[model samples]
Target: MTQILNGARKCFVQRGFHASSISEISAAAGVSIANIYQYFPSKEALIIALIELDLQRHRSLISRFWSTDFSPKAIEELLADIFLTPEGHAVAVLRAEIASEGARNPHVAELLRDSETGLIGSVHSLIRAAQRRGQISNELDPDLITERLSLVFEGLMRLYLFSPANGQKLIEQYYRQFADTLRLRP
Candidate 1:
C-alpha cells in the first residue's frame, strides 16, 4: 500500500490526476493491479490520500510562517525562498497541476478547501497576535485581513514561480514593501 501511494504521488505530480491511470500507477509502484486495490479502491482514493499528506506538510509550513519567530529580514528571505528556490518551483508545479485538476474534480475540491481553511486560520491567528500586541489597529478584523493577505501572497507567489530568473528582484521588493502597506499597525 505504501509503495503504491508513494508512486501515485510522483506520477500525479508529473502527469496530473486526470492524465494518470491505475495501470501507470501500478507500474510505477512495482505492484500489480490487484495489490494496489488492496489499499485504495480506486485512483481517486489514492489521490485524496496524497492531497491529505501534502496538506499536512503545508500546515506545518504555515504555522512556522505565522510564528514571527525570526527577524523581519528572515521573513523577507522566506518569501524570496518560496518564489525563487528550486524546491519552491517543484512544489508550485505540482500544486498548480493538482489545483487545476481540482477545478473539475469534486474530491480534489474537498481537499483544496480544507487546506485553504487551515492555512487561512493560521494567518488569522498571526493577525490576532499583532493586534493584541498593539501593532495593528484594534478595529481591523483578523479574519478578513488574513483572507486578503493570503490571496495577495498566493498571487505574488504564482507570478514569481512561473518566471523565477526575472521574478526574484520584483518579488523581493514586494516582500520588503509589504509590511509598509499591509501591516495596518498604528
Candidate 2:
C-alpha cells in the first residue's frame, strides 16, 4: 500500500491530479487498477493520499530541521540541498499543482493550507529564536517577518518552477535577502 502510494505520488507529480488516470497510476505502481482501487477507492482518494503523504513529509522535515543550533542562513543551504534532488523536484510540481488545481480540488487546497501552517510556524520559531539570541529586534512581528520570508521563498520557487533556465540565481537572491533581513544587530 505504501509502495502504491509512492508510485501514485510520482504519477500525480508528473501528470497532475486531474489528468492522471487510475490505469496510469496502477502501471506506475506496478499494480493492477483493481488492486489499486482495493486500497484507494478512487483517483480523488489517491490524490488526497498523495497530498497527505507529502504534507506529512513536509512536517517531518520542519520538525527535524527546527533547531537552535542552525542559523537561518544554514537552513537556506539545507533547503537548497534538498530542493535540488530528483525527489525534491516534486516540491515544484506540487506547488504548481496546488496553484492550478486548488479551485477544483478542495483536498489539495486544504493540504496547501496545512502545509502553509507548518511553514509559518517553522518561520515563527526561527524568528523567535533570533530574538532570544539577540539576533534581531524583539519588537518585530514574527508572523509578518516569516510571512515575508516565505513569500520570497515561494516567489523564487515560482520563478524556478516554470523556467529552470533562470536557474538558482533567483533562489540565491531570496536566501541572501532573507538572511540579510534577519541578520543580528551590529
Highest TM-score: give the candidate number. 2
Which residue ranges in model 1 land beyond 4 Å of their true spot? 1-3, 30-32, 134-139, 170-174, 184-186
Reference-based TM-score of each model: 0.76, 0.81
Task: Name every residue pair that clashes in candidate 1.
Answer: none
Candidate 2 RMSD to the real structure: 2.8
What lDDT would each prediction earn against the true structure?
0.71, 0.71
Give each prediction's root-mean-square deviation over alpha carbons. Answer: 3.3, 2.8
Model 2 vs. true fold: TM: 0.81
- Candidate 1 lDDT for residue 114: 78
Error of 1 at 152 (Å): 1.8
Q: Total clashes, candidate 1?
A: 0
